[model samples]
Target: MALQIISVVLFTVFFSEALTLMCYNCNTTTECTQANCSSSCSSMTNHNGNNITFVKKCADSAWCFNSSINLGLIWMSSQCCSSNLCNNATVSENGLSCYTCNDKDCTNRLKCKGGEDHCITATGESLQNTVKGCASKNICDNITLLNNTLPQQHLSSSCCRGNLCNNAQKMTQGPVLLLVPILSLLFYILGLF
Candidate 1:
């Protein structure tokens, strides 16, 4: 009975170890520590000019993919691997250039990296601030779909292809667009009188 119990315990330990994936986990400049999970390991990196930030952790394979956001002076990306302890830091090169905004100035150029293929211009909820950058088609599509479903859009965004296509002035509808219908109605009422 003693030998049988020992064999059972050993089998359980080996089986559990085989089922778990060990990954490196860390953030920014921190040293990586081993972490266990059932999914793949990921390494995410952000490059802002000369500065670089790196993160490593275990993540689901379904959510892992190479993606990037380019903000002229800054860029970010994420990568994933399935093998144990395979989350090595890696930086992807930007292939396209686009206009980006900083404060009120939208003249700066940004390199679009990873899977980004579109130039994006977005306005905040308050409409007082605008941001321009490079984004993946997935991000642009989801933003468009979400905006179309809202009765009153809290955020407005536009996406275009080719370099510097987003350089055009703010794309959000202004108060002037709202005044058109009101002005037309007033003209019809006055003409009737």
Candidate 2:
């Protein structure tokens, strides 16, 4: 009986692994078809000025989260789920907002969408090459995952949870502000002698 129970458990596990989740697959703004995935389903929305595009397909679970990316000229947002046929064309605004960077300007206002609750500031090798936008908390916790969604890699990121909190000036001035009290204390100690 014990041997039979072990065999049944193994069979159940194998059967579950064989079952795949179905997702809606589409690239254009046209009709979508069914696609099978072993992990998760994904829906991605790309916004460029007045134009908006949508893409739906199967994705890996490791990439399953709502995240937004801004690469200067273009901004893309993706939402992922682990249920069958869960990749729908509903990318709603989450009421949070942040700033997006462009080659000419870094003050473009971006409305957070899907599960984006945090503002992200991602910088490349040089501080000059920076991208700021809205992101989900999952992406904030694992900033390296942004490389998968971006055209470029080697980006370090910082996340904040407030309106337009990714402003560059605040981040640059933070270190200088910290030195103020320390410098004052040192001068006071020198004068005491």
Candidate 3:
């Protein structure tokens, strides 16, 4: 009986589907749908003075800082969380910080989003300019060769730990703002109905 009970427990633990997380999956100005996954992510991108927010279900739990690529002039930052409908709540940007440079000089700074713990520097992607920003440790470790390569160009990248360690000529960190309490209050008020 003891062996039978142990087998049942092990089977349940290994085959449980309760670990799946519900996330809001949507792109810029698109319809939001529900998805089940291991992680939820909120990505914010800024391009040409415009900001767009995206939410999605993710397999990996990680985030990124102000990263720019040769595709366009933009910055992408993502926040990941693990809770039921947690992506609907505010994600804290209290992670690492890094400098982001697209085509212009590396003067702007981007705050690291959730789970982004490493700073990355990449250059030579046909554009022949350097881009520095924060990235998740997983991406840095598993995506070295392609760091400087994409479908259209060749690229090279290096990763490092430490805040603002991307080695920008002028190191500047983005402003850290807290909005948890306010969002909570807003939700509480709405729930009063």
Candidate number with greatest TM-score: 1
Candidate 1 stretches greater than 4 Å from native = 1-22, 45-54, 73-76, 145-153, 168-193
Residue pairs whose backbone atoms clash in candidate 2: none
Number of backbone-clashing residue pairs for each candidate, in the order shown? 0, 0, 3
Best by lDDT: 1
> lDDT tens string, model 2, 1-193?
9999999999998988679798999877678999878988888776555677778888877645566554334556667788889888576687888887545356777788767788987665522355677767755766544444333434466889998898843223111122222222322332210
44-93 in candidate 1: lDDT tens per residue? 76666678777888888876765555666555556678888988754555
lDDT of 1: 0.66
Question: Over the full model, what C-alpha lDDT does candidate 2 score relative to the true structure?
Answer: 0.64
Better of 1 and 2 by TM-score: 1
lDDT of 2 at 48: 59
Model 3 has an lDDT value of: 0.51
TM-score on alpha carbons, each prediction: 0.62, 0.56, 0.52
Off by over 4 Å in 3: 1-27, 30-73, 77-82, 147-152, 170-193
> What is the Å distance of residue 154 in model 3 from its true position?
4.0
Q: Write the per-residue lDDT of candidate 3 for residues 55-154, one digit (tens) a residue.
A: 4444365432222221123433344557766555544575667876634557567787655678776554354456676666544664543532253545
Candidate 2 differs from the real structure by a C-alpha RMSD in angstroms, to one decimal, of 14.2
Which residue pairs show collisions in model 3? 148-155, 148-156, 149-155
